[model samples]
Target: MNPSASKIQNPETTVPKTPQMNERDFINDQLTTEKYMTNSYNIALNEASNQALYQDLATIFKETQDCQRNLYNLMFKNGWYAVEQAEQTKVQQTYQQFTGYKSQLPYSVQ
Candidate 1:
């Protein structure tokens, strides 16, 4: 007759079963989580009003970014991930494209 007891003993409520996870699965999950964390930190960093908070978030963001990069390197070394190298010409073109925007800035170098 108790409401709490009924809720606790509800037959429709079910817990999710844990799936089998391996090393690659764990690394992939960790890498994905860290990437999300860095993205969230970036948004928070942009919206932070206090300088101290901004600096703290910036440091944490950098650390998370480094950790994510390290995980990527590990996966790459283990052949778990395949990363293609950019051609030198493509790299040079991209560099030139970005550098072309320097003249669009409002500030002029004296």
Candidate 2:
């Protein structure tokens, strides 16, 4: 099979090449910022000492995550984001590999 056959992408929306930033550049920058914020919020959430602070961070984290998702969706809709379709065999192999390690876990998964 052709390697590119599994690529799942829409026709790219073109943007004019210019010194100034375009719509794609602006959105991409915001997306990058959102991603960084989410990561920071995640770390803060993990090490939060106070219950109230934790809750506040959690809310903010969720909002940031939602915003990130929205940005991702917008980029995808505009054909700025492209994802590759995973091969079924490779997916199944990964699944089986992980499943085989279940017995090594301290707690039961089921």
Candidate 3:
């Protein structure tokens, strides 16, 4: 075996390249992961049998949620995320559709 070829084939001899993530992608990835963690924390809080554990998890969940929100706001401010404003007519139509279905519910609301 050639020495130069062996060096090329050896994984340990090769330099490990770090993943290149753009600012937008980095922030988006962090926000997505935090949102997922927040959801998991919510589930844990709901199933928590110990009050102390529940309180601790609730605090962490709120913090994670806030972090996620902050990331989203930053991205929005930087124009990384585009949000479209809904038309008033479309909003009214959605409201009417839900209200119509609400009347068909089995439980009566006073």
Winner by lDDT: 2
Question: In angstroms, how far off is 6's CA in candidate 1?
Answer: 62
Model 2, 1-110: lDDT tens per residue? 55755766778889989999999999999999999999999999999999999999999999999999999998998899988888788889999998879867878563
Candidate 3 versus the native: TM-score?
Answer: 0.67
TM agreement with the true structure for every prediction = 0.71, 0.90, 0.67
Instruction: List lDDT for all candidates, in order.
Output: 0.77, 0.92, 0.77
* Stretch of 10 with least lDDT, candidate 3: 6-15
Point out the worst 10-residue segment of candidate 1 by lDDT.
Answer: 6-15
User: Candidate 1 local accuracy as lDDT?
Assistant: 0.77
Please provide, for model 3 over 7-110, each residue's C-alpha lDDT reduced to its tens digit, 9 standing for 90 to 100: 21212222234677767668889989998999999899999999999999999999999999999887776666655555667789999999998888877661
lDDT of 1 by residue, 27-105 (tens): 8799999999999999999999999999999999999999999988766666666645556677899999978787677
lDDT of 3: 0.77
In candidate 3, how many Å is residue 73 off? 0.5
- What order do you get sorting by lDDT, best first? 2, 1, 3
- Please tell me which model should have the higher lDDT, number 1 or number 2: 2
